[model samples]
Target: MNCDQRAIRFNCLGSSMIGIIDLPERPLPRGVLVVAGQPDSRLGAQRQFAMLARALARRGFAVMRFDRRGVGDSEGCDYNDSDVRAAVQEFCQQVPGVREVVLLAPGSGSAIATASACARIDPRVRALLLLDPRRRANAARTAHMLAPPVPAPAPIGAALFWRRSQPPRRGPSSGARLAGLAEQLCAFPGQVLVVAATSAWAGPTPAQAEVRQLRALVERAGTSNRVQIIDDAAPAPADRAAGGRLDGDALRAATCASWMVSW
Candidate 1:
């Protein structure tokens, strides 16, 4: 499979945001949206996002990555739902071959991805691939980074695609945000694949503690989902390090490919 890339721009709030898309000669209707956490550009740690996008594209998915508001080429003061929603919209609009989408959120960004998909912010979003899902270690930092979405809308069923973007409130405590995410996730209708990164070599546990929580919540959602635990050759790094310099990139890639085919 061969892949190519292009630049794309969209509007979030009053600001203009930019992203990159990896295109395959022939693409599946389901695309991928790679959400980079706030203060991090789409380039991801050491440009690993760039590498991942191309890899997914080669696997026959239309893949995309972009800057958060106020980061990279995007223009905005901070992160918000509108940023993720806008990116979702752009992904669907730009990739004519893509109908539904899957989100791949590496770390804290998993919080954002869960909010968007589980909350039903966009109808096109169908599944999630979360890598080492974990919350921020610092509560105050989490407050500074995340903004809570508006009260969720009633389930619209067939009306989902025509729904409008929900409003948002900025700077909530991590505890508050986590509680909200828990509630929404239990209602999410899509399948979730959580990649729990840990191992004896990884020096903690082969299964992450957060992975257990995530699985429990997802199972309660009443949807069929899967959890795949792969051993890390070394202790897992923070989101930044994991994204950029992990020696287990090939393993992650293989896992993604396998799950996607099974999906």
Candidate 2:
């Protein structure tokens, strides 16, 4: 499906904000409203947001990306909760088919602030997409000024673990325990083989990137021992037979058993 892109303007507290809406031939009820950031505006760093909007629109989703105060054609030097509400209102009004919206904040620079502002967003905003939450840098200074306070942190994602002869536990451990375990592994008088899982699904996930980071950290920490990865996906091929789960499970078991027996 083809997407049509057009510029738009909206008023928030008497200031004009510029934006672009990516409309698909047949749009879905759920749309993406990109929360503009500083120094990049709605285009994003290297036009990432624009490309993202177009790509999403091609897949039948309606995407709206607005500019922050300082960037693009937007006026004034500040934006607030009013701007967000106005944008959401404009987004819904522009795309009548879209009843709900998901706010996408691209970087950690303002990830927390953006999410914080929407703590009590309009009912039409169904979700928040904050990319790179691992490296949060700033908090909206005026966040407290908003009527309802920002909700407590409700992070989503899997916890990383390190397995040993008698590992800490079978399931996810607390952050403190995880840190202590990492320190313990670095101090242990033996080799460490970090086993991180990869997906049969396409594209690079945070888990995979974290696996690489773990390997690098271990290499630096355990300077004397030989550290290696046991489940690195070297560009996994398509699941031809669609039995990726069966094959992956069998391979993981065999690899672990063989490694233990060899040791």
Candidate 3:
């Protein structure tokens, strides 16, 4: 079926956030608001998310994806903790006839989704779909970048160069902060689906400690939860050249998950 997509700007907490709404030619079953990763506008607006949104629309879901504050066409300088919460709150409130909300997030956006859910006293959020979340690792990277550099003796020219070349160091790791935020979100009442990339960071399997922490949090939340890890098997040459579009089976699985709840 042909999908109808519209781009619009809406005011949220005194800022204009840009978004695209996709509707199926037929009636929709429910509405989903997708949150994108850090530095990514509305599901990366990439082929993967766009294809997923279009697929959901075909399966009777009205999907909306937007640029977070300070990203893309959205108005803002930077997104802080509170702005993330406000953006989600506004997105939840603005979508019309949304019976249920599936907070879909990827990468760093997962923490934002969790925080937003935790901050809400309202019962609009029904489920969460976290695709390849990197809460701890992302936080760690951020902290490393922000951490203060140690001073060392150097020649005048060397010292000047070091001052310009050294990266800022901030206290506490982003991963640690995200863990705290995740704990808060787990307290909220909702189902969660975690999709983890097996080849995440092009490294070895996920750290046991990280996996254990995530599992414990999900269990403690008392919410319906499932974790799916993508395999790293190489595709056939023909398929590989096709740019890794999700297979039919993957598409079906995501659609089922997206529409799991009743409005």
Candidate number with the higher lDDT (1 or 3) = 1
Alpha-carbon local distance difference test for all models: 0.68, 0.60, 0.59
Which of the predicted structures, 1 or 3, would earn the higher TM-score when compared with the native? 1
Off by over 4 Å in 1: 109-114, 117-119, 135-185, 200-247
Candidate 3 lDDT tens digits, 1-263: 67788786776568877888787666343466677666777756345667667777767677778777788788987665454455445555555556666666664544545545443644666666665555434655678478898786766887788988989867655457546646644654565555544543355555434655655655665543433223323234343324566364244335444436432
lDDT of 2 by residue, 1-263 (tens): 88898789988777889999999999988787888666678987677677667767766778899986656888878766667778889999999999877676643434434544554446666554444322222124334566587686654444222223345534333343334434443543333344454552557776566545545666667542444444434333442226543334334323433432332
**lDDT at position 56, candidate 3:** 77
Q: Could you tell me every candidate's TM-score relative to the true structure?
A: 0.68, 0.53, 0.63
- After superposing candidate 2, which stretches have Cα over 4 Å from the reference? 135-263
lDDT of the structure predicted as candidate 3: 0.59
Candidate 3 colliding pairs, count: 9
- Sequence-dependent TM-score of model 1: 0.68
TM-score of 3: 0.63
Pairs clashing in candidate 3? 139-174, 139-175, 140-175, 146-168, 146-169, 146-170, 147-169, 147-170, 148-169
Q: Rank the candidates by TM-score, best first.
A: 1, 3, 2
The better candidate by lDDT, 1 or 2, is 1
| Candidate 1 global lDDT | 0.68
lDDT of 2 at 104: 69
Model 1 C-alpha lDDT per residue in residues 62-90, reported as the tens digit of each score? 99999988898988878866777788888
The candidate that wins on TM-score is 1
Quote the lDDT for 16 in model 2: 87
